[model samples]
Target: MTEEQLQALLHEMTTAEKVGQLTQFAGAFYSEQEDSTPVTGRIEFPVEEDMIKESGSVLGVAGAMKLMGIQREHLKKSRLGIPLLFMADVINGFETIFPIPLGLGATWDPALIEELQTISAKEAASAGLHISFAPMADLVRDPRWGRVMESTGEDPLLNSLFAAATVRGLQGKDSLIANDRVGACVKHFAAYGLAEGGRDYNTVDLSERELRDKHLPAYKAALEAGVKLVMTAFNTVDSIPATANSTLLRDLLRGELQFDGVVISDFGAVQELIPHGVAENEAEAAKKALEAGVDIDMMSLSYAHSLASLIDEHMIDSTFIDEAVLRVLQLKNELGLFEDPYRGVSLEKEQTVVGHPSHLALAQTVAEKSMVLLKNENVLPLDKQTSVALIGPYADNQDLLGEWSIFGKTDQTTTLRQAVQKQYTHAIYAKGSQLYERDEELLKEAIAAMEQTDCLLLALGEGKDRSGEGRSRSSITLAPCQIELARLAKETGKPVIVALFNARPLDLTELEPYADAILECWHPGSEGAKAVVAILSGKVNPSGKLTMSFPRATGQIPVYYNAYQTGRPLPPGSNERFFSRYIDIPNEPLYPFGFGLSYTSFGYSNRSLSSAKWDGSGILTVSVDITNIGEVKGDEIVQLYIQDVVGEVVRPVKELKSFQKVSLSPGETKTVTFEISHDMLQYYHSDLTFASDPGQFRVYVNGSSVCEEENTLTFSLVKS
Candidate 1:
C-alpha cells in the first residue's frame, strides 16, 4: 500500500479502531492458548474478542501455522483489514539458539555477531515473526542487573558497533521485509542498564551529559543503521517514568535524535506509570504516554481501556491517535501484509528452516567464538583420550539456553557429558551440586567419580531463571555449595577444569584458586556443549574476550576499564591511605574488559603514529605490528585506546576508539592500522556540545584493557 492508501485507512479508522492500532497484547488475549507465554505481564486482562481482532500487533506468538491462523482471524474482523504484526523477544537465536547477547559481545567480532543475527532473522521469519525485540542496545556497567546478559557491554563505541551490525543483519541492507529478514527493534531506549542498585525496573538518575555520552549512543547507532523500532526503558529517567516522559520520548528521542520510527513501551511499562506514582489512573497514564510520543502500548490495558475516553474528554488530542495509527498501518504496508498477510510463512518452511543443519553449524561456530578463556595455567585443550569426570548439575542437563530463549527446544541441547561421551570412551559424569542447593550424597558421588578419573570438569553457576529480567542478584559470587563442589574436586588431587554456565559475570575470586583452568562458557545455547568440548579438545582455540568487566567483588559492582579520572587521584606508587582507594579490594576489576587469553600468544610491537599533531578535520593513522609469538594458529583482537589528557569535562582514563580482530599462524606478523579522524576525539563537553578541543592525547595499542606491556604514542588535537 502507498502512503495515500495508508493515510486513507487512518482517516477512516474510528477512535476505538485507532486506539486498537496503538495497542498490543499477548496471545492469550486472542484465545490462542491458555498456556501461552505471557510476553510482559502476568495478570490476565479481560480482553474482548473484537479487541483482539482489531489489535495492531501480538507479542510472543510464533509458528507458521499459529501465526497464519491469528492473521486470518484478525484480518477478517479488522475494519481497515490491517494485518497484525507478530513480534517476539528473539534476543539471540530463534530455534537454533546462539549464545546470549553478552557472549556475542565477548566475541569482539561484529561480523560474527552480524552473521548470528542473520541466521536469527531467517529462523524467526520462517516462524512467521515480523519483528525481533533484539540486540538489547543497553550499555551495562553493573553486572548485578540480571538483564546484563542481554547487553553488548558498558562501552558506547563497542555497543554502537554491535548495534549497527545487528540492525543490518536483522533487517538486511535495503528492505526490512526482504528475504528471511525481519524488522529489528533496538530496545530499552534510555538508560535501562543503569538501574539503581542494579535492580531491574529501578530508578535511573543520569545528568543530560552522562545520558548522551554514555547511554544514548547505542540507540542512536541502531537508528542510524535504519532500525525500524525503539522500545522504551522500564526504568524512570530523572524521576519521570520513561513510558510517559516527553523529555525522553519527545524532546530527546524524536526531537534531538530524529528517530522517525515507532516508539514502543517495554512490556506493560505504560500502565506501570500508575504504580510509579506519575499517573493517577489508567486514563491519565494513557494520555501521558500517547502525548509523549509512545506510538504503541505493549502488553498493557492502558491504551485499550482509556485512550478513546481521554480523546473524548479533551484530555488528549485525536491527532495523536491518528498519528500513532498511521505509523502502525505504514509498518503493515512495509511488511507487505496488505497484499499477503501470511508473508510467505509456511509449515514446510518452518520445518526446513527453523533448525536447519547449516544454522546449527553456525550456532556452534558462534558458540565457539564466544567462549572466553579466563584462565589456562597450561591445563587447557584437554587430551581427547584422557579419562574425564564431568561433575555438575549441568553435566547431563539440557537447560543450556539461557533466559529469553523462548523459541528454543531444550531437548535439542547437547549436555557437557553427552558431548564428552561422544568424543571419548572414558568419560564419567555425576551431579556435583545443584545451582543453589547442596546434596551430600551428590557431592560424595561426584568426589568418587573425580577419584576414578584422570581429571575433573566441573560446571557450575546460576540457573536459567537467575540472570534475566526481574532476576537481579544482590551477590554475584558462585553459590556456596557450588564453590564447595569445586573445592571438593580440587581436594581429590586432580586437575580441575571449571566450565561456568552463567549469564552475567560471576565473582570468580573464590573459585579461581581451586581450578587449574577456568572457561567462562556463558550459557552457550543449543550447541553450547559441543563448542566447549571442541575448544577443550583443541579443535577450536579460545579467542573470545570479555565485553563487560568481571568485578573482583560485588563491592565493585559498576567497575569498567573506561572510568573517569578523579580529582583526588590515588598516589601512583605510594599506595597512599588517604586517596580514592578501596580499603579491601583494589579499584581495578578481577578481569578487565577486552581481556581474554588463547592457547597461542600474540605480541605487539613497533607502535607508530603518522603525526604528532592533527588539525580539527584532519586524519591521523595509528599503526601497530602484531606477531603470533606462540606455536599455534590463533585469532587476536588488537585494541586501540585514547586518553584526553585535558578536556572541557573530565574524560575517561582511556576510551576504546578502534579495534581489529586478526588471525595469524605461528611466527606470523601483520601490521594493523586505525585511521583516527577528528570525530574519534569528540566528547560531550561541559557545555553539552559534542566536539574535540585543542588538547594533548595519549594513544595506546594493546591486547586487553589492562595492558601492562602496552605500546603508547602521544599526539595532539589542534584548532586549524
Candidate 2:
C-alpha cells in the first residue's frame, strides 16, 4: 500500500481501533495452543475480546502452522483485515541455535556474525516471525548485568560494528525485509547497560557526555544499518523511564538520531511507568508513552484501556494516536503483509529449514571459533589416543543453549561426553557435582574416573539460567562445590582442562589456580560439545578472544581495557597507597579484552607508518607483519588500538580502532594493513561536538590489547 492508501486506512479506523493498532499482546490473548512454546510471561492484564481482534501484533508465538492459524483467526475478526505482525525474542537462533551474543563478540569477525544472523533470520522467518527482538546494542561494562550475555561486549566500536552487522544480516541491506528475512529490532534504546550496581532493571545515572560517548553508539549504528524497529528500554535515562522520557525517546532517538521507525516498548514497559513513579495510573502511563513517541505498547493495558478515553477527553491529542497507528500500518505494508498475511510462512519450509544439517554445520563452526582459549600450558591438542575423563555438571548436560533460547530443545543438544567419546574411545565420564551443589557420592565417582584417565577435561561455569534477563550475579566466581572439585582434581597430579560454559565474563581467579588449561567455552548452543571436542582433539584451533574483561575479583565490576588514565596513576611494581589502586587486589583485570590464547604461537613485527603526520583529509596507512611462529597452523586476530595523547576531554588510555582475523599455516607470514582516516579520531567532546583535536597520537598493533611500550608507534594529527 502507498502512503496515501495507508493514510486512508487510518482514516477508517475508529478511536478504539486506532488505539488497538498501537497495542500488542501475547499469543495467549488470541487463542491457546497445546504445543505453543511459552517464550514470554503470562498475560497479567485483562485483554478484552474486542481488543484482541484489533490488536496489531502478537508476541512469543512460533511454529508456522500455529502462526498461520492465529493470523487466520485474527483476520476473520479484524474489521480492516489488518494482518497481525508476529514478533519473538529470537536473540541468538530460532532452532539451530548458535553461540550467545557474548560468544559471537569474541569472534571479532563482524562478517561471520552477519552470516550467523542471516542463517538465524532464515530459520526464524520460516517459522512465521516478522520481527526479531535482537541485535541487542547495549554497551555493557559490567558482567554482573545478566543481560550482558545479550550484548556484544564493552567496547563502543566493536559493539557498534556487530550491531550493524546483525541488522544487515537480519533484514538484509535492502530497505524492505525479504521473504526469508525478518525485521531487526535494536533494543534497550538508551543506556540500559549502565544500570546502577550492575543490576537488572536498575536505575541508570550518567552524564550526557558519557552516555553519548559510550552507550549510544551501538544503537545509533543499528539504526544507520536500516533496522526496522527500536525497542524502548525498561531502565530509565536521566531519571525518566525510557518509555515516557520524551527527551530520550523523542528528542534524542527520534530527533537527533532520526529513527523514524516503529518504537515499541519492552515487555509492558508502558505500564511500568507507574512503578517507576512517573505515572499515577494507566491513563497517565498511556498519555506519557504516546507523547514520548512510543508507537506500540507491548503486553500493556495502559494503551488499550486508556488511549481511547484519553483521546476522547482531549487529555491527549488524537494526532499522537493516529501517527502511531500509521507507523504500524506503514511497517505492515513494508513487510508485504498486505499482499500476503502469511508472508513466506509454511509448515514444509519450517520443517526443512529449522534444524537443517547445513545450518547445524554453520552453528558448529561458529561455536568452535567462539570458544576462547583463556589459558593453555602446552596441555591442549591432546593426542586422540589419550585416555580422557569428562567430568562436571556440564559433562553430559544438554543445557548448552543459554538463556533466551526458548525454542531450542536440550534433547537436540550434543553433550561434552558424547562429543569426547566420539573422538576418544577410552574416555570416561562422571558428574563431580551439580551446577550449584555437591554430593559426596558424585565426588567419589568423579575421582575414580579421574584416576583412570590420563587427563581430566572438567566442564564448568554458570548454568543457562544464570545469565540472561533478570539473572544478575553479585558473585561471579564458580560455585564452592565446583571449586572443591577443582582443588581435588589438582591434587590428583593429572592435567586438568576446564571448559567453561557461561554467558558473561566470569571471575576465574579461584578456579585458575587448579586448572592447567582454561577454555572459555560460552554457551555454545546445539553443537557446543562437538565444537569444543574438535578444539580439544586438535581438529580445530581455538581462535576466539575476550570481548569483555574477566575481572580478578567481583570488586572490579567495571574493569575494561580502554579505561581512562588517572591523575594519580599506579606505576608498575608500585606499592603506593595513595594512587588509584585497590589495596587487596590489583586494578588490572584478570584477563583483558582482546586477550586469548591459540594452539599455535604468533609473532608481531615490522611495524611501519605511511606518514609521520596525518592531515585531516588524508589516509594514514599502518601496517604490521604477523607470523605463525609455532609448528601448528592457527588463526590470529590482529587488533589495532589508538591513543590520543592530548584531547579536549579525558580519553580512554587506548580505544580499539580496527581488527583483522587472518588464517596462517605453519611458518607462514601475513602483512595486515589498516588505513586510519580523520573520521576514526573524532570523539564526543564536553560540549557534545564530535570532532578531533590536533595532537600527537600513539598507535599499537598486536594480537591483544596489552602491548609493550617498545611496540608503540607515534604519529601526529596536524591542524586542518
Candidate 3:
C-alpha cells in the first residue's frame, strides 16, 4: 500500500494496534536467562504478553522462527489482526545444509548457486517462514573475518554475477514457495568491508573509490535482481552506524540504487547505536534509525517504544515510519500473504523437504568443485595398499563441515575418516589433538602414528565454530596444535598430504615447509568425505581456483590482485624502505590471486590481439592457445586480465575482465579466444560517466586463473 493509504489505515488503529504492527520477534533464538539474569553474549530482546497484545502485530524473527501453534495464538490476540512476518536466517539451507557461499563461489557455477538458493527458499517458505536473511552480498578482502564464509568471495564482477543469480533463485518457483518461498534479504550494506582489525562490528572507514570499486558491486547486483529487503550492517562507515547513515540508507540504497525494499537493521543494531555512542538511548536509536531508512528493526524494541512518540513529537517524520512499514507490508503482499497467511510453509513439509536426498547431491557437487589443489608434490593419489594415517582432530570430527551450515546432522555427515575408510582398507585413524588443543603429548602420539604409515593425510583447519558471524581471528595461521602435528608428520619422512578445511584461506608458510601436497578442501558437507577421497585418489582431479587472495601474513590484509599501482612501482630488489613493498615479507601474496594448482598441467601461448583499435560498437577478439602438457585430462579456468595504459582515473594493475573454464586431454591443444568491447574497457569516471579513453591496452592470458604472461596491444576508442 502507498504510505498515504497506510497512514489512513494506521490512523484507524488504537495505540496498542499501532504498537503491535511494529513489534516482531523470532522466538526460537531467545529464552529467558536462568536466575532472571539476561543471557550474556547472546542477542536478547524482552517482550511481555501485554506488549504482544498491545502491539498491532509481532514478527516472529530469527531464532524464534514460525511455529504453527504460537502463530495461531498471536493471530487470535492481536487487536488489529495484523500477522507477523516469520523470518529466519535461511542462508544455504533451512534444513538441507548446502556449502557456504564462499564454497559456492569457488565452483564458479551460477546454476549451482541458483539451485541452492531455490532449494533453500522452497524449504524455508514451505515451513511457513515468510522471509529469509540470505545472499549475504558483502564483498570483502580481509579473509580474517569469520563472516567471509557467508559471502561470495572478493571479486566485484564474480560477486555481482553470483549475487544476482542467488537472489533470483531464492524468489523460488514464484514469489512464494508453498506459501514458503521466502523473500531474500541482501545484508550488511554500505562499506562493511572496512572492518577494523578484521573484527565483526568494527569501524569501517574507506574512500569512495575503494567503496564503489571493491565493496558496492554485490549489493548493486542483488538490488538489480529485485531483492526486496536489505539488512543494515553491524559496522559503521565513516563513524556513522550503517543503520543510521542517511546517505547510505536514504539517499543511496533507496534513492540512487533505486531499492524499494524494506530496510531492516542487523540483529540488535538499532539498540547498539547507543553503545556505538551515536545515540543516547534506545529512544534516540529508534528515532535516528527510522529517519535514516531502517524499516523493520530486527530484535530491538527501541522502535516499539520510541518510534511512536517520535512520530507524535515530530522528532521523526510519521511519513518516514509509514514508508518503512509499507515496504514491509508490501513484501507481505508480494509474498501473497493477504490471501492466505499460511502460504509458503507447513510443519509437515518442513520435516520432509529439508535435508532430502536430491539437495544432498547438490551439496556434494558444490563441495567437489570448490576444492582447490593448492600444491601437489607427486605423493598424492595414495595407492589402495598404502597405509595412510589420518591424523588430526578434523579427520573424524563432524564439526568441520565449515561454518554457516544450518540444521546439519553431524552424525549423518561424513567425516574424512568415514569417506576414506570406505575406499581404502589400509587407512588408520588417530585424533592427534583437539582442534583447538594446546597439549603436546597428544601431538607426540600422532607423530608416532605418522611414523607407522607410508603416507599421512593430515586434516587441519578451523573448527566449524571458528568461521562464521562474530568469529573473526587475529592470527589466521594453522592453529598452533595443528602446526606442531604437521611438523611431527614431516619428521617421520612420510608423504604428508594436508587437507585444509577452512572457511577462509589461512597463512600456510609453516605447513608448506613440511607438506608434500596441500588441498584447500574448505568445509565440504556430508559428501565432504567422499569428495576428499575422490581428489586424494585421483578419482577427481582438482579444478577449482582460489576466489580470494591468500595473504602471506596478517599485515598484508586488504590485499588483493586488483589494486591500483602506486606511482612508484616496487623495484624487486630495491633498497628503498619507503616503497609500497614490505620489508620483512614480499608485498606479493603467498599465492597470487586466481592461483590454483591442478593435479595435471596446461601451458598458454602469447595472446594475439585481432585489432589494435576499434569503435565502441564492434567486437575485439583476442585469441590465445593452450596445450595440456600433463599426463591426465583436466579442465582449466583460463583467465584474461587487462590493464589500461593510462586513464583519467587510476585503474587496477589488473582486473579480471573475462575467463573461460575449458577441458583438455593429455597432449591436447586448443585456441581459446575472448571477445571484448567497451563493456570490458569502460570504467566509471570522476564525472560519473563510464568512458573508455584512447590508450594502449595490455592483455594477458594464462592456463591457470591469472594471466602471468603479458602481451600489449595499443587500442584507441573513437569518440561516439
The Cα local distance difference test for each model comes to: 0.88, 0.91, 0.75
Which is the better candidate, 2 or 3, if ranked by lDDT? Answer: 2
Tell me how many residue pairs clash in candidate 2. Answer: 0
Report the Cα lDDT for residue 427, model 2: 93
Could you give candidate 1's per-residue lDDT for residues 186-216 as a string of tens digits? Answer: 9897889999999998999999899989888
User: How does each model score on TM-score?
Assistant: 0.98, 0.99, 0.93
| Stretches > 4 Å off in candidate 2 | 34-43
Q: Write the per-residue lDDT of candidate 2 for residues 598-680, one digit (tens) a residue.
A: 98999999999998887878689999999999988899999999999888998889999999999999999999999898988
Q: Candidate 3, residues 37-73: lDDT per residue as tens digits?
A: 2111356556766665554323333221344555567
Q: In order, what is each prediction's RMSD in angstroms?
A: 1.3, 1.2, 3.0
Task: Mark the regions of model 1 whose C-alpha exceeds 4 Å error after superposition.
Answer: 34-37
lDDT of 1 at 440: 89
